[model samples]
Target: MIAVGDKAPSFHLAASRDRVVDSGDLAGRPYLLYFYPKADTPGCTTQACGIQEALPQLGKLGLVVIGVSPDPVAQIDAFADKFNLEFPLASDPDHGLADAYGTWVEKKNYGRTYFGMERSSFLVGADGIVKNVWRKVKPEAHAVLVAEAASKL
Candidate 1:
Protein backbone atom coordinates (compact mmCIF):
# COMPACT_ATOMS: atom_id res chain seq x y z
CA MET A 1 0.00 0.00 0.00
CA ILE A 2 1.09 3.64 -0.56
CA ALA A 3 2.40 5.56 2.41
CA VAL A 4 2.99 9.13 3.41
CA GLY A 5 5.67 10.99 1.44
CA ASP A 6 5.43 8.59 -1.49
CA LYS A 7 4.61 10.10 -4.86
CA ALA A 8 1.02 9.24 -5.84
CA PRO A 9 0.60 7.43 -9.12
CA SER A 10 -1.04 9.41 -11.92
CA PHE A 11 -4.28 8.18 -13.44
CA HIS A 12 -6.97 9.24 -15.91
CA LEU A 13 -10.41 7.73 -15.40
CA ALA A 14 -13.91 8.39 -16.73
CA ALA A 15 -16.20 10.53 -14.63
CA SER A 16 -19.57 12.22 -15.07
CA ARG A 17 -20.28 14.40 -18.15
CA ASP A 18 -18.10 12.13 -20.32
CA ARG A 19 -15.07 13.86 -18.84
CA VAL A 20 -11.90 12.22 -17.71
CA VAL A 21 -10.22 13.07 -14.41
CA ASP A 22 -6.47 12.80 -14.15
CA SER A 23 -4.08 13.21 -11.26
CA GLY A 24 -2.03 15.66 -13.30
CA ASP A 25 -5.12 17.76 -13.81
CA LEU A 26 -5.12 18.36 -10.06
CA ALA A 27 -1.57 19.62 -9.89
CA GLY A 28 -0.97 22.38 -7.37
CA ARG A 29 -4.11 21.37 -5.51
CA PRO A 30 -4.64 19.10 -2.53
CA TYR A 31 -7.10 16.29 -3.18
CA LEU A 32 -8.65 13.25 -1.60
CA LEU A 33 -8.58 10.00 -3.58
CA TYR A 34 -10.84 7.50 -1.88
CA PHE A 35 -11.42 3.93 -2.99
CA TYR A 36 -14.59 2.07 -2.17
CA PRO A 37 -15.67 -1.51 -2.85
CA LYS A 38 -18.84 -0.86 -4.87
CA ALA A 39 -21.49 1.66 -5.74
CA ASP A 40 -24.88 1.95 -3.95
CA THR A 41 -23.76 -0.28 -1.11
CA PRO A 42 -24.46 0.76 2.47
CA GLY A 43 -20.93 1.36 3.66
CA CYS A 44 -19.94 3.09 0.47
CA THR A 45 -23.00 5.29 0.73
CA THR A 46 -22.13 6.28 4.29
CA GLN A 47 -18.56 7.11 3.38
CA ALA A 48 -19.54 9.16 0.35
CA CYS A 49 -22.16 11.06 2.29
CA GLY A 50 -19.68 11.80 5.06
CA ILE A 51 -17.38 13.41 2.56
CA GLN A 52 -20.26 15.25 0.94
CA GLU A 53 -21.30 16.65 4.30
CA ALA A 54 -17.81 17.98 4.84
CA LEU A 55 -17.34 19.37 1.35
CA PRO A 56 -17.32 22.98 2.45
CA GLN A 57 -14.57 22.42 4.98
CA LEU A 58 -12.59 20.39 2.52
CA GLY A 59 -12.98 23.11 -0.09
CA LYS A 60 -11.73 25.65 2.40
CA LEU A 61 -8.58 23.61 2.55
CA GLY A 62 -8.42 23.71 -1.25
CA LEU A 63 -9.07 20.01 -1.46
CA VAL A 64 -10.75 18.24 -4.34
CA VAL A 65 -12.57 14.99 -3.64
CA ILE A 66 -12.75 12.11 -6.09
CA GLY A 67 -14.20 8.67 -5.46
CA VAL A 68 -13.13 5.52 -7.32
CA SER A 69 -14.60 2.06 -7.69
CA PRO A 70 -14.59 -0.90 -10.05
CA ASP A 71 -18.23 -0.12 -10.87
CA PRO A 72 -19.21 1.32 -14.22
CA VAL A 73 -20.28 4.85 -15.13
CA ALA A 74 -24.04 4.28 -14.98
CA GLN A 75 -23.97 2.95 -11.42
CA ILE A 76 -21.61 5.72 -10.38
CA ASP A 77 -23.93 8.34 -11.77
CA ALA A 78 -26.94 6.78 -10.04
CA PHE A 79 -25.21 6.67 -6.69
CA ALA A 80 -23.94 10.21 -7.01
CA ASP A 81 -27.41 11.41 -7.95
CA LYS A 82 -29.15 9.49 -5.17
CA PHE A 83 -26.84 10.93 -2.59
CA ASN A 84 -26.64 14.38 -4.14
CA LEU A 85 -22.88 14.05 -4.14
CA GLU A 86 -21.11 17.12 -5.47
CA PHE A 87 -17.76 15.49 -6.05
CA PRO A 88 -16.58 13.46 -9.00
CA LEU A 89 -16.89 9.70 -9.03
CA ALA A 90 -14.32 8.01 -11.22
CA SER A 91 -14.91 4.67 -12.89
CA ASP A 92 -12.06 2.20 -12.56
CA PRO A 93 -13.74 -0.80 -14.12
CA ASP A 94 -10.47 -2.54 -14.98
CA HIS A 95 -9.06 -1.85 -11.52
CA GLY A 96 -6.00 -0.33 -13.19
CA LEU A 97 -5.88 2.73 -10.96
CA ALA A 98 -6.80 0.66 -7.92
CA ASP A 99 -3.91 -1.68 -8.55
CA ALA A 100 -1.57 1.24 -9.15
CA TYR A 101 -2.57 2.79 -5.84
CA GLY A 102 -2.43 -0.59 -4.03
CA THR A 103 -6.08 -0.45 -3.04
CA TRP A 104 -6.96 -3.76 -4.70
CA VAL A 105 -6.15 -6.85 -2.66
CA GLU A 106 -7.31 -10.10 -1.15
CA LYS A 107 -10.24 -9.67 1.18
CA LYS A 108 -12.29 -11.88 3.48
CA ASN A 109 -15.96 -11.89 4.39
CA TYR A 110 -18.13 -14.57 6.10
CA GLY A 111 -15.21 -16.97 5.99
CA ARG A 112 -15.00 -16.46 2.25
CA THR A 113 -12.03 -14.94 0.45
CA TYR A 114 -11.90 -12.89 -2.71
CA PHE A 115 -10.08 -10.09 -4.42
CA GLY A 116 -11.62 -6.68 -3.81
CA MET A 117 -10.88 -3.06 -2.98
CA GLU A 118 -9.55 -2.54 0.54
CA ARG A 119 -11.54 0.52 1.48
CA SER A 120 -8.74 3.05 1.46
CA SER A 121 -8.13 6.75 1.12
CA PHE A 122 -5.12 8.82 0.15
CA LEU A 123 -4.40 12.42 0.87
CA VAL A 124 -2.34 13.80 -2.00
CA GLY A 125 -0.63 17.10 -1.55
CA ALA A 126 -0.21 19.92 -4.05
CA ASP A 127 3.18 18.52 -5.04
CA GLY A 128 1.67 15.05 -5.79
CA ILE A 129 3.16 13.14 -2.88
CA VAL A 130 0.88 11.17 -0.59
CA LYS A 131 0.42 13.08 2.63
CA ASN A 132 -1.46 10.35 4.48
CA VAL A 133 -2.97 6.94 3.79
CA TRP A 134 -5.90 5.32 5.53
CA ARG A 135 -6.05 1.63 4.79
CA LYS A 136 -8.80 -0.77 5.88
CA VAL A 137 -10.76 2.26 6.91
CA LYS A 138 -13.92 2.26 9.00
CA PRO A 139 -16.85 3.71 7.07
CA GLU A 140 -18.06 6.02 9.80
CA ALA A 141 -15.88 9.00 10.70
CA HIS A 142 -13.60 8.38 7.72
CA ALA A 143 -14.39 11.69 6.08
CA VAL A 144 -14.04 13.58 9.32
CA LEU A 145 -10.65 12.07 9.92
CA VAL A 146 -9.57 12.68 6.33
CA ALA A 147 -10.73 16.28 6.52
CA GLU A 148 -8.75 16.72 9.73
CA ALA A 149 -5.69 15.34 8.03
CA ALA A 150 -6.13 17.74 5.10
CA SER A 151 -6.52 20.61 7.52
CA LYS A 152 -3.18 19.68 9.03
CA LEU A 153 -1.62 19.78 5.58
Candidate 2:
Protein backbone atom coordinates (compact mmCIF):
# COMPACT_ATOMS: atom_id res chain seq x y z
CA MET A 1 0.00 0.00 0.00
CA ILE A 2 1.13 3.55 -0.65
CA ALA A 3 2.47 5.37 2.37
CA VAL A 4 2.78 8.96 3.39
CA GLY A 5 5.14 11.02 1.23
CA ASP A 6 4.76 8.70 -1.74
CA LYS A 7 3.56 10.19 -4.99
CA ALA A 8 -0.08 9.29 -5.49
CA PRO A 9 -0.82 7.06 -8.45
CA SER A 10 -2.28 8.95 -11.42
CA PHE A 11 -5.75 8.30 -12.75
CA HIS A 12 -8.40 9.69 -15.09
CA LEU A 13 -11.89 8.44 -14.33
CA ALA A 14 -15.47 9.09 -15.24
CA ALA A 15 -17.17 11.10 -12.54
CA SER A 16 -20.47 11.61 -14.32
CA ARG A 17 -22.04 11.13 -17.70
CA ASP A 18 -20.84 14.60 -18.64
CA ARG A 19 -17.67 15.00 -16.61
CA VAL A 20 -14.34 13.28 -16.26
CA VAL A 21 -12.04 14.04 -13.36
CA ASP A 22 -8.36 13.46 -13.94
CA SER A 23 -5.34 13.62 -11.68
CA GLY A 24 -3.74 16.02 -14.13
CA ASP A 25 -6.86 18.19 -13.89
CA LEU A 26 -6.17 18.55 -10.18
CA ALA A 27 -2.46 19.24 -10.47
CA GLY A 28 -1.09 21.70 -7.92
CA ARG A 29 -4.19 21.22 -5.79
CA PRO A 30 -4.46 19.29 -2.56
CA TYR A 31 -7.29 16.74 -2.48
CA LEU A 32 -8.72 13.80 -0.69
CA LEU A 33 -9.11 10.58 -2.66
CA TYR A 34 -11.32 8.07 -0.88
CA PHE A 35 -12.11 4.54 -1.97
CA TYR A 36 -15.23 2.69 -0.97
CA PRO A 37 -16.52 -0.80 -1.68
CA LYS A 38 -19.92 -0.04 -3.15
CA ALA A 39 -22.33 2.72 -3.99
CA ASP A 40 -25.31 3.53 -1.76
CA THR A 41 -24.30 0.90 0.79
CA PRO A 42 -24.58 1.70 4.48
CA GLY A 43 -21.03 2.43 5.43
CA CYS A 44 -20.23 4.06 2.15
CA THR A 45 -23.31 6.27 2.42
CA THR A 46 -22.31 7.40 5.86
CA GLN A 47 -18.84 8.30 4.70
CA ALA A 48 -20.04 10.13 1.61
CA CYS A 49 -22.63 12.10 3.51
CA GLY A 50 -20.13 12.99 6.18
CA ILE A 51 -17.82 14.38 3.57
CA GLN A 52 -20.70 16.31 2.05
CA GLU A 53 -21.44 17.87 5.40
CA ALA A 54 -17.80 18.74 5.89
CA LEU A 55 -17.41 20.37 2.50
CA PRO A 56 -17.37 23.85 3.96
CA GLN A 57 -14.43 23.09 6.23
CA LEU A 58 -12.62 21.12 3.59
CA GLY A 59 -13.14 23.98 1.16
CA LYS A 60 -11.51 26.34 3.62
CA LEU A 61 -8.46 24.14 3.44
CA GLY A 62 -8.62 24.10 -0.37
CA LEU A 63 -9.07 20.35 -0.44
CA VAL A 64 -11.08 18.81 -3.23
CA VAL A 65 -12.85 15.56 -2.46
CA ILE A 66 -13.14 12.74 -4.93
CA GLY A 67 -14.78 9.45 -4.07
CA VAL A 68 -13.75 6.33 -5.99
CA SER A 69 -15.74 3.13 -6.24
CA PRO A 70 -15.70 0.10 -8.51
CA ASP A 71 -19.34 0.73 -9.30
CA PRO A 72 -20.49 1.78 -12.78
CA VAL A 73 -21.24 5.29 -13.96
CA ALA A 74 -25.01 4.89 -13.80
CA GLN A 75 -24.98 3.60 -10.26
CA ILE A 76 -22.63 6.36 -9.17
CA ASP A 77 -24.95 8.90 -10.69
CA ALA A 78 -27.91 7.52 -8.79
CA PHE A 79 -25.95 7.55 -5.58
CA ALA A 80 -24.92 11.16 -6.00
CA ASP A 81 -28.45 12.23 -6.75
CA LYS A 82 -29.91 10.33 -3.84
CA PHE A 83 -27.51 11.88 -1.38
CA ASN A 84 -27.29 15.34 -2.89
CA LEU A 85 -23.53 14.89 -2.90
CA GLU A 86 -21.62 17.90 -4.17
CA PHE A 87 -18.33 16.16 -4.88
CA PRO A 88 -17.09 14.01 -7.67
CA LEU A 89 -17.55 10.25 -7.29
CA ALA A 90 -15.57 8.42 -9.91
CA SER A 91 -16.20 5.02 -11.42
CA ASP A 92 -13.46 2.36 -11.35
CA PRO A 93 -15.31 -0.60 -12.82
CA ASP A 94 -12.16 -2.51 -13.77
CA HIS A 95 -10.33 -1.96 -10.51
CA GLY A 96 -7.30 -0.48 -12.24
CA LEU A 97 -7.38 2.66 -10.15
CA ALA A 98 -8.14 0.67 -7.03
CA ASP A 99 -5.17 -1.57 -7.70
CA ALA A 100 -2.87 1.38 -8.19
CA TYR A 101 -3.96 2.90 -4.89
CA GLY A 102 -3.70 -0.45 -3.08
CA THR A 103 -7.36 -0.33 -2.11
CA TRP A 104 -8.17 -3.56 -3.92
CA VAL A 105 -7.62 -6.67 -1.77
CA GLU A 106 -8.72 -10.16 -0.90
CA LYS A 107 -11.75 -9.88 1.31
CA LYS A 108 -13.59 -12.55 3.28
CA ASN A 109 -17.17 -12.17 4.29
CA TYR A 110 -19.67 -14.79 5.52
CA GLY A 111 -17.32 -17.60 4.51
CA ARG A 112 -16.95 -16.23 1.01
CA THR A 113 -13.67 -14.86 -0.23
CA TYR A 114 -13.38 -12.32 -3.01
CA PHE A 115 -11.39 -9.40 -4.24
CA GLY A 116 -12.96 -6.10 -3.25
CA MET A 117 -12.08 -2.57 -2.34
CA GLU A 118 -10.86 -1.86 1.16
CA ARG A 119 -12.26 1.33 2.58
CA SER A 120 -9.31 3.70 2.34
CA SER A 121 -8.56 7.38 2.04
CA PHE A 122 -5.48 9.34 1.00
CA LEU A 123 -4.61 12.93 1.75
CA VAL A 124 -2.58 14.19 -1.21
CA GLY A 125 -0.76 17.48 -1.15
CA ALA A 126 -0.66 20.24 -3.74
CA ASP A 127 2.59 18.79 -5.08
CA GLY A 128 0.94 15.38 -5.69
CA ILE A 129 2.57 13.44 -2.86
CA VAL A 130 0.45 11.52 -0.40
CA LYS A 131 0.40 13.34 2.92
CA ASN A 132 -1.47 10.71 4.95
CA VAL A 133 -3.28 7.43 4.46
CA TRP A 134 -6.12 5.67 6.24
CA ARG A 135 -6.47 1.99 5.49
CA LYS A 136 -9.67 0.14 6.35
CA VAL A 137 -11.15 3.42 7.44
CA LYS A 138 -14.29 3.54 9.55
CA PRO A 139 -17.03 5.51 7.88
CA GLU A 140 -18.71 7.06 10.90
CA ALA A 141 -16.07 9.60 11.79
CA HIS A 142 -13.55 9.48 8.98
CA ALA A 143 -14.55 12.77 7.39
CA VAL A 144 -13.96 14.71 10.56
CA LEU A 145 -10.52 13.25 10.93
CA VAL A 146 -9.65 13.81 7.29
CA ALA A 147 -10.80 17.41 7.43
CA GLU A 148 -8.62 17.96 10.48
CA ALA A 149 -5.63 16.51 8.69
CA ALA A 150 -6.23 18.57 5.57
CA SER A 151 -6.40 21.73 7.63
CA LYS A 152 -2.85 21.11 8.72
CA LEU A 153 -1.53 20.51 5.22
Whose lDDT is greatest here? 2
Q: Model 2, poorest ten-residue lDDT window?
A: 12-21
Model 1: lDDT equals: 0.92
Residue-pair clashes per candidate: 0, 0
Taking the tens digit of each residue's C-alpha lDDT, what string does model 2 give over 1-153? Answer: 799999999999999555798999899999999999999999999999999999998998899999999999999999999999989999999999999989999999999999999999999999999999999999998998898899899
Q: Pick the candidate with the highest TM-score.
A: 2
User: What is candidate 2's TM-score against the reference?
Assistant: 0.98
Report model 1's TM-score to 2 decimal places.
0.96
RMSD of each: 1.0, 0.8
List the candidates' TM-scores in order.
Answer: 0.96, 0.98
Tens digits of per-residue lDDT, candidate 1, 63-106, equal 99999999999999999899999899999999999999899999
Residue 153 displacement in candidate 2 (angstroms): 0.5
